[model samples]
Target chain A: MDVSNLGLIDFHAAYAIQERLVAQVASGEAPETLLLLEHPPVYTIGSGGSEANVLDPAISVVRTNRGGDVTWHGPGQLVGYPVIDLGRRGRDLHRYLRFLEELSIRVAGEFGVAARRVPGKTGIWTDRGKLASIGVGVRRWVAMHGFALNVAPDLEPFARINPCGMAGCPVTSLAREADAEPTVAEVAARVECLFPHLLNELLPCETETEGGRHVCCRLQVARGKAPLDVR
Target chain B: MATEITMPKLSDTMTEGRLISWKKGVGEQVNRGDIIAEVETDKANMELEAFTSGVLLETRVTPGELVPVGTVIGIVGAAGEAVAAAPVAVVPEPAVTETAAAAETAPAPAPEEPPPVHLSVAGEEAVKASPAVRRLARELGIDLQTVQGTGPDGRVLQEDLERLGGAGVTVAEPAAQPAVAETAPVAGTEPAAPRTELHDALPLSRMRSAIAQNVSTSWRTTPHFSVTVEIVMDAAAEVVRELREGGTPVSYNDLIVKACAMALFRFPQLNNSFAGDGIRMNADVNIGVAVGLPEGLLIPVVRECQRLSLREIAAESRRLAERARTGSISQQEISGGTFTISNLGMYGVDEFASIILPPQAAILAVGAVADRPVVRDGSVVAAKTMRATLSADHRIVDGLYVAQFLGEVKRLLENPVLMLV
Candidate 1:
């Protein structure tokens, strides 16, 4: 896995990088990559998201081809785009989402903050509020549009829209939960350190039969070994 | 042959998905990799690509329609080729409902002879048993067609299998079963095997029925282990009194909820649930305080206790309890409890263990805060003490974790000011 720390980049620039990396990885010209960056104040909605969730008409919203509702992105938040080819992997998109959540959970844990997954909801959360948001887009079995961790972002923008289509959803950050305030780069570093281990543990390469053609599919590592697979 | 396009499984956990829109219209030429539709799975929306090239012949489902995976949503075939009829057995219009004039003009086709009943032929007769009962019968090696159903409409039931098994028939019990003495206690106590005059049977109220069913389910499924701790509630009582004098109306249970929230923050395992094959760690410490009513009980939750102030929790718990007693509580108020606190302190009960609430890992049972003799400084002394037992699912947390959680709760209650900080 290749980790690039591209700090303070525009959302569109970061998305373009993700698109390029996805195409490269899908074509076997590049290794699986992790692009870490931060976006200026912006609100983005998933392709399936409803426009009615945006409470404030003034805030500009970017519609993207991802798998979640409207969410906020800004400088204080750490955005990570994991460009990986799922063809050689299990090709299970749900498991890929869980893998991203587990990465975020470990990153939060590195800062002495406890994060967990709420049943029937996608995101890593603390008791205080949700700590991270994850949405992905897959083109030809290549995943993009990864997760955003609230390191120390201004939560005011989130109140302008229903975060993940949930009304009155509370958002929290590492600065609030941890003993000391941490920067987005610091958190992204921890993510880069933890991503490969979790990816191997949760979404390891395996072989199984699919379409009755002896096509190799990934079998989940034993559930006990992969605790995050509880979802 | 026309190829049917079914909803694709986009995720491992998605049982069904919504068809957001069709990218291609009927009669549109489609290549093998053409995007045919967009689907909203449980996680996100993804484009559904065609696997084989053909012209779209029919659209079986409309946009925004939610259907189970593998349900055919469209048909694709060569140009000018007619699509095959759907596999569903189309029911013809009934001749029985026809008027007398229509029947006289054209004699209705002679009624087909009814097929001979073959009890052994599976799929010939539709069984009325639920999926669970059918599964149980299969596990017990009992054939549903042979067993006489005692339930309404002659439906085979779980109890029928039990009856068959007890009769020493074809049903085979698992080996290595422990032998129980005939003198074993059934239903706790059997009234000393003495006859008594029978009274009129009374039906269970809705609340009672719910309680019975819930507790039975919890007892049967949850492997519960309890740890008891004695806490000197002198400080907690003083804080409660101070709050009550200040018009906050704080109760002992409210203090316990505050303390439990703090302890749960430290030990997230206690706030977890025993999901099969793994555990679900709940992010919010939504403490459900069990409120006893005249008929039964209602546990109204004080949600996200980690964010609530002590005074706020007191007010919410009091309001919920009042609403529960008045039978005016909303569903949202009584649901989403990550942990539960059941107190019989008002009734002056000493101590008791509660059944672990399903999905939730643990329940804290708080006893009355009363004066009790304690040995302090190697001498007997009276102190305002209470006994609290934590019943937790062993599958999620062990006795050590439960003890540490209970100890933290005790530490917070004993040092009541720590909760404020």
Candidate 2:
């Protein structure tokens, strides 16, 4: 995972970075990149989104190609845009999404938040509503646009639109969930740091297993250790 | 024209779905019959396909966010033209507004319901606590179901309960209590609060959940009944002992598989699956031997068990079972089993009932061969006895037929030489 932190960047600028990185990755010009940053306030809807979801027409709404209904990306939220070539991997998009979710869940667990999967729902959830939202697009099997986990974000803009196209769906933050206000960088660093570790857990390393398959994957990162305070 | 791609109904029970991931990017050319996305429904993860040949336009829904069925998730249209024909207006500037910032101070998402305190589980007779706390509390003669936990999800912590009150509050007389025993909550109560605790949990793997879904469906729909027979294994045990002693190692389970295959002839109902249209009697008496793995249970069938001699039966079953354990067993090996045998005899389990695999009519649960007293002629004498249970799908297998089939198995096993031939 080639991860870059473009701290507190403009939404369109970050999107350009994503596009550039995606093209580079697809062309084998650069390695897969995971771009993490906080976007200034913006309401983005997909092409399939209904205008009815955008309550306040004045809010800067960028129509994106990413999957999902309208969503809010602002200062406190850490938006991760992974410009990764999926063809080199299994090219299984659903499994890739589940890996992203598992990464978020593990990151939440580091902060003592009991995040879980709701049966039919997409996002990582606590008893509180969704804690994060994920949307991505792929071209030639190269993925772009990723997850947005609420860190210390102002969730008020979420009320302007039916977030995730569902009315009255409550969005939560890492700080709110953990009851400690950690910076978006800290959460972003944590999720970025834990991403590959969690990815290998779900996707598995089949090539290594080929040598001797009978032995179970006998490795675990020691738990109950303090999360590295990368803030 | 850019056409909207809405959420497709993945299953009968599906009301909502999570877009797991998108396979197509904006401006990516996609043809009809190409899979464009994967959505997770209540039952399983289903593949979503592109219905029209076009370039992917825009996706409206993000992965991990749940939306209802028929919610438009993406659009597809002619590539360069679609980019010009905007679906929705991109507002120039999102107003950083007044009411929005104030809305933060408005109220936190419905001031979350205060977390609940843990309560005692009554009639369980055992304290609802962790093994560590439950043991510690019992050593102090304290009832676990009596304490309220302050820990996460109301789980009783040892430190919290230890600081409750007086130490070693003996509920039972020391003379009456046995040493190092799992204390059951007795009738009389010197109870304070019931002990409640929670343990860590991991999400069930897809394999585990699939096993759960399949077996649960089998359990709910099938009407099941079990019949037991204790065959005095004096002769059968001798046959096994002789085989081991003769350097050809074979197990009692192997002998039983052979016996069951022979019994299939006497009772053909055991070898047939009940199709809704009619009973499909399989020509081959392929026996499925249940193999337990760390992840889940698998049944590998040893085909044409009746044709194989006792020695051949032993080798084939072990090979199939070993492959099943190593996770290399093929689809053909796992399927077409007309009968199944689940043995916990090695674990010292006696006469345990088992569930029948779907479509197949019967499963034999074999128990340990033990030395017990049985009447021979007039007086009760010490003899080796083994219990075998037949859990049959009652829709097809009648009780009397099950009895006759079990009787035949007993005769075949007790006359141990019959299986060798």
Best by DockQ: 1
Q: Considering only N, C-alpha and C atoms within 3 Å, which residue pairs clash in candidate 1?
A: A208-A217
Interface RMSD (C-alpha) of each candidate?
7.7, 16.5
Query: Which 10-residue window of candidate 2 chain B scores lowest in summed lDDT?
Result: B110-119
Per-residue alpha-carbon lDDT of candidate 1 for residues B138-255, written as tens digits (9 for 90 to 100) = 3233456657889989887777865553111222222222334344545655455432111122335546656776788789989999999999999888988887798778878888
In model 2, what is the error at residue B15, expressed in angstroms?
14
User: What TM-scores result for chain A when each predicted structure is judged separately against the true chain A?
Assistant: 0.90, 0.85
| Chain B TM-score list for all models | 0.56, 0.59
Candidate 2 accuracy as lDDT: 0.68
Q: Give the poorly placed runs of model 2, Cα more than 4 Å off.
A: A1-231, B1-22, B25-35, B38-201
Runs of candidate 1 with Cα error greater than 4 angstroms are A206-227, B61-65, B80-272, B276-336, B339-358, B361-421
Q: Tell me the TM-score for chain B of model 2.
A: 0.59
lDDT of 1: 0.75
- Among these predicted structures, which one has the highest TM-score? 1
DockQ of candidate 1? 0.23
